[model samples]
Target: MTQAEGGLRARKKRETRAALAEAALRLALEKGPDNVTVEEIAEAADVSVRTFFNYFPHKEHAILGRNPEHIERALDRMREAPAEESPLTTMRFIVHDVLRDLEGEGELSRRGELIMASPHLLYQLMLSSFEDERQLTEALAERMGEPATSVRPALIVSASGAACRVAMERHKADPDRPIRELVDEGFQLLAEGIDPGFRVVPTKGHP
Candidate 1:
């Protein structure tokens, strides 16, 4: 296809994906995920069910679409980042960049509200976060270009991942708050340090 045609096709695909996501979000918020069938979503999107499958591997995936890809894109964006940027800074770049995509369209806020409306969708978001974390850690490790077993890369990833998760959960709980401010707070908390025992706890009635 000519360059112009290729651009048009890309735009069409983006539109299709957006439409499907919007439909799924609306139905999820309106009826609940269990009640919203893939067929209904496809119909709402103005596409055949087959086209829906073509875009998303499963119904839940349609809701998680582009999230991981957004992280990968941010990772790619900093391929030539200056050496002066700390690992925390690089992670902040990725965090903000991924969020930028979401807020660029009211779609992020809408879909986020949808996820809150459905338990299944909330689980899907958690699963998506795990996958995205794995992909992101591995990408950062590879960028570090050191042994996978190295402590520095692992530590960087663990710290960043924990910080980011806290940031996300805070936003989910309060969409009205500034996402960037939350992320900064998360990273600051990391810098201040979490309690070593925070990851584990005693049984009830025990010290």
Candidate 2:
């Protein structure tokens, strides 16, 4: 009931969630996602199966290490952007803030590789991303003083998601390249407006 007690409880919960996710990723790496089970993950993390369910709805989420709080934090940051800033500018800030933390985390690259190797995990990740985009659309609409059903908000959020996805794919291909640079370039292209039919021209007789 005391503030200290509540804080301790929250911290413990986070520790449990993180332990479960780490165990899940380890098991997934050794046995693949299809071979890992909730019971095994819980046992590995020293938690009960019920506790694992409390942290993650399914094993894929644990393997992906998807944190719902990150989405909420990004939404909060986007909503706080200056009213004078354009939506794209606000989005750029949000994307950078959310992903910058991953720069030094080597585990993220490993997780990305694991996800890419499994078709089912990739599908689950895509579904989770779509849900995050939907939440972001709603938040953006609120900040823009528009209805959630408005076309512009949906368009902006969807476009931003697509750009981020492309950047991530490129990062996966070349881990040496800084992901932040790719993400920035993707947002820059969005800000500059890409020509729908734009194509590269061949030099000399190269065509």
Please provide TM-scores, in order, for all candidate models, with all chains considered together: 0.81, 0.87
What's model 1's lDDT at 57? 73
lDDT of 1 by residue, 74-169 (tens): 668556566777666787777777777777756666675566667787787777666666666666677777666667766765677667556656
**Candidate 2 local Cα displacement, residue 194, angstroms:** 1.8
Per-residue error (Å), model 1, residue 143: 2.3
lDDT per residue, candidate 2, 1-207, as tens digits? 999999999899877877888899999999989999999999999999998999999999999887777798888888788889999888888777667544433466778788888999989999998999898899899999999899998888888877877777888888887777887888888878777678889999798
In candidate 1, which residue pairs get closer than 3 Å at backbone N, Cα or C atoms, i.e. clash? none
How displaced is residue 156 in candidate 1, in Å? 3.4
- Point to the candidate with the largest TM-score: 2
Per-model C-alpha RMSD: 4.1, 5.4
RMSD (CA, angstroms), candidate 2: 5.4
Q: Write down the lDDT of every candidate, Cα atoms only.
A: 0.73, 0.85
